[model samples]
Target: MTEKEKMLAGLPYQAWDDELVILRENAKLLCHQFNHLAPNETAKRHTILSNLLNIKGQFHIEANFFCDYGENIYVGDNFYSNHNLVILDVCQVSFGNNVMLGPNVMIATASHPLDPVARRATEFGKPISIGNDVWIGGNVSVLAGVSIGDNSVIGAGSVVTKDITGNGVYAGNPCKFIKSI
Candidate 1:
């Protein structure tokens, strides 16, 4: 299978493969262009994002947004992400409509093998999915293979390690449900 196919399938693959490297380079270039635009260049910024990610409908993403393989990330309508948002989209990372992410939030789909020998040779990835009407607080880290259910709120400085299936407020490191929202 191709490197991209391996990545999407959550199988081990060389991240530095020529094809993957090229895709990352192109995404970096587009992100650079989007990040350096004038404040008034809204139309151009949208155009750049149009070329970079699968952004559907409307979104107001702040500057300094970083991602790997932007094409693997998808954002639905009415999305708003604060500054310094990073998405490591080695696999697919999808955010549903009305999703909002606070500053310094990271959604990472990339993962390294625990085996030292295997880690150097190949990397794998898992998908991250955020349901509609979700709000992820500042400094939160959403790890690989996680899904936050609809209308849930992730408190600031939290690290999400597992899937949250029910709607509620979650907080703390390795975030746990605080209370139902």
Candidate 2:
């Protein structure tokens, strides 16, 4: 299968070493479009300057956002991000309706293998899914293969390394459930 096909399938693949070069080139073109628009263009340009990857009914964004591929990331209606939202969407990053993200929040779906030697040669990405009405606080980092369940809240500056099943508050460096709501 083609490399893009493998990526779409969520299968492991090598980054082809030149991925960043291609991304840089594409980013320049996309940025130019973003910069030159008159504030109503759709279908490639961002919905709002402050808000990057918004679907209909999604709201504000305060800081910069970097996405590997914008089309692979989909946000549901009424989504809101505060600031510094970065998504390394090597795979699909889907958000349900009414999701809120605070400052410095990162949602990553890319990860290297555990072994250092293997890490250099391979890249793996699992889809990151966020259910409806979830709230992620400032400075939080979400790792690969995670799903934040519906109605859950992630505390400030927490690093989420695993799945959270919903209806609770999660915190800490590795992000553990603190209480259920």
Candidate 3:
């Protein structure tokens, strides 16, 4: 059987790396489109905010929200979410002050398996947190086990998979701290 099939069968597996890579690629594609899509507004803000989902703070959407299960998400003051924002929030996703999310940005708190025999279908999640004054560029994906520090700037098309402590600029897959901001 294929590795994906084995994982989906719900067998025991250690699945942090393999799932993370696939998830990053998928999320990157989604965010890429989200960043470029135009907002559907007639008179006022035609933002996408689902009632069946949970959202905090005075929501200001300069775009659309394709959120999946919005129960575990929170936004802080002066928050600005640009077009094509998708959040797969299975666990807590907290964003701090003056957080600016560019187009097609996604914050996902989900995971799967690594072992080919145990990677097909199993799923899990971790928490994500963005500190104050964080500016995330368009097409950025913040993965499950990530916590960005205050005053950090995530460049466009970057994928963050680990905790960022110092304030700085980060970009690329498996986002690395580029420079102090």
> Which residue ranges in model 1 land beyond 4 Å of their true spot?
none
What TM-score does structure 3 among the candidates reach? 0.69
Residue 6 error for model 1, in Å? 0.5
lDDT on C-alpha atoms for all candidate structures? 0.92, 0.76, 0.69
Per-prediction TM-score to the true structure, in the order listed: 0.98, 0.82, 0.69
Residue 77 CA error for candidate 2 (Å)? 0.7
Query: Over all chains combined, what TM-score does candidate 1 have?
Result: 0.98
Each model's backbone clash number: 0, 1, 13
Model 2, runs deviating above 4 Å: 17-24, 27-54
C-alpha lDDT (0 to 100) for residue 56 of candidate 1: 85
Query: What's model 1's lDDT at 158?
Result: 99
Model 3 lDDT tens row, 30-136: 44444345555422332234232344556566545665444456777778888778887656788887889999998887666677655574566677889999999
Residues forming the 10-long window of minimal summed lDDT in candidate 2: 43-52
User: What is the descending lDDT order?
Assistant: 1, 2, 3
Using lDDT as the yardstick, the better of models 1 and 3 is: 1
Give each prediction's root-mean-square deviation over alpha carbons.
Answer: 0.8, 3.8, 8.0
Across 31-71, the per-residue lDDT of candidate 1 in tens digits comes to: 89989998789999889988899988999888888888899
